[model samples]
Target: MSVAEPRRIVLFRHAKADWPQVTDHERPLAERGRKDAAVAGRRLAGTGVPFDLALCSTATRTRETWKLAVHELPQRPKTVYEERVYEASPGELIAVLNETPDDVRNLILVGHNPGIQGLAEVLSGSAEGDARERMTRRGFPAAAFALVSFEGSWKTLEPGVATLLDYWAPSE
Candidate 1:
């Protein structure tokens, strides 16, 4: 008999990317990004979202965005930086997730995209149309989150094992 693994992975695409004005890694959030992140945080908290682990890219925007979005949680989980996750490809993202500790029930990874979207599209068991479209729409906005469930253990999870559970984006 096969043993069951229990875990949920949440991927957060960093808030809107800054344009030509500043360096990519150093770009600060646009005014709206801050508000959007706060709202997103509240939404996550209000929904009673729980996660045992949190990982983030080392980039400035990702770091800042994650701080804002997760602030609404009643009890913050420990967050660590995954330097490989900075501007990483989908394969790289999956590798980091696969390495997560097995005891965690829920896990969150925050980084930039098209990497995030690429990872989401690759892992999701959801049909190509709706889940992909919604992620495309929501993932990049200032405050958006995607909740997905995978069919296997974090270490064994493959791209097609994931199912898009829910999505939320802060509205203006």
Candidate 2:
């Protein structure tokens, strides 16, 4: 039997956003946000994981975060911006992942929180260790990144079925 390759998903929260002068959806990334995005991007790239696709939210800040993060990647992945991701619930985020094409194994989801954070926690389940404890205590902060790996198709993903491979956030 052929070995099944593990599927990986990277959940990233948008970097810091500028103060509100416009609608929430229109808020742009601040200078700090830009720098943070770059740092997070490099960190993600350093993991040596090649992303096959990126599913991003349509909001300006979210979109900008994805653009800046992907800049550090060696290969640019196909990206799709979905309106449903903006202010999405944890279930909604899972739904988005469920819809991904089966051929795309390594996928990234760049959006906001606590949806991102919540999804990370839910997927982590009872997999306890230093990383899980650390993430639990700190919570998923801005520009935080969580890499989860599972052994099946994207459509079959469910809570507590994936392991947290790594978690990181941009330095202050």
Candidate 3:
């Protein structure tokens, strides 16, 4: 039997956002956020993980985060802006994953916290070292990302089915 290509899911929480914006969705990334995003991008580029698609939240912060992160990527991946991911719950995020087309193997999700953090927590089957410890301690902080590998298709993904490959948070 031919080996199945591992479905990699990269969960990226938008970098730190400034509070000056009038609305939550209108908020922009802070100075530190830009720096952190660039660093995160460089790190991602080093991994040589070529993403096939990215589903991002419509919020300004999320949009900005994706924009900056992709700058360091070797190749720009196809991106879709979905309003539903703006503040999606864990279940909602799972639904989004389930709806992904089978053709898209490598995926990236750039969104907000609580929801993103919640999704990462529930889906992470196993992790090791300081990364796991940091996740448990601080949860998903701004500019933090969790890389997971799933053996099954996106449609079949469920809690504890994927392994957390890496968790990273860029410092200011």
Ranking of candidates on lDDT, top first: 2, 3, 1
Candidate 3: Cα lDDT at 50: 88
Q: Give the runs in model 1 whose Cα sits over 4 Å from its true position.
A: 1-5, 127-133, 136-139
Would you list the clashing residue pairs of candidate 2?
A: none
- Candidate 2 wrong stretches, greater than 4 Å: 1-3, 126-129
- State which candidate has the highest TM-score: 2
Cα RMSD for candidates in order = 2.9, 1.8, 1.8
Model 2's TM-score against the true structure? 0.94
What tens-digit string does per-residue lDDT give for candidate 2 at 76-122?
99999999989998899888888888888898999899899999988
TM-score-wise, the better of 1 and 2 is 2
lDDT of 3 by residue, 36-143 (tens): 888888888877788999999999999998999999999999999999998899889999999988888888999998999888888987875566777777678899
Residue 137 displacement in candidate 3 (angstroms) = 2.8
Worst 10 residues of 3 by lDDT: 1-10
TM-score against truth, every candidate: 0.86, 0.94, 0.94
Model 2 error, position 124 (Å) = 1.3
* lDDT over C-alpha atoms for residue 172 of model 1: 53
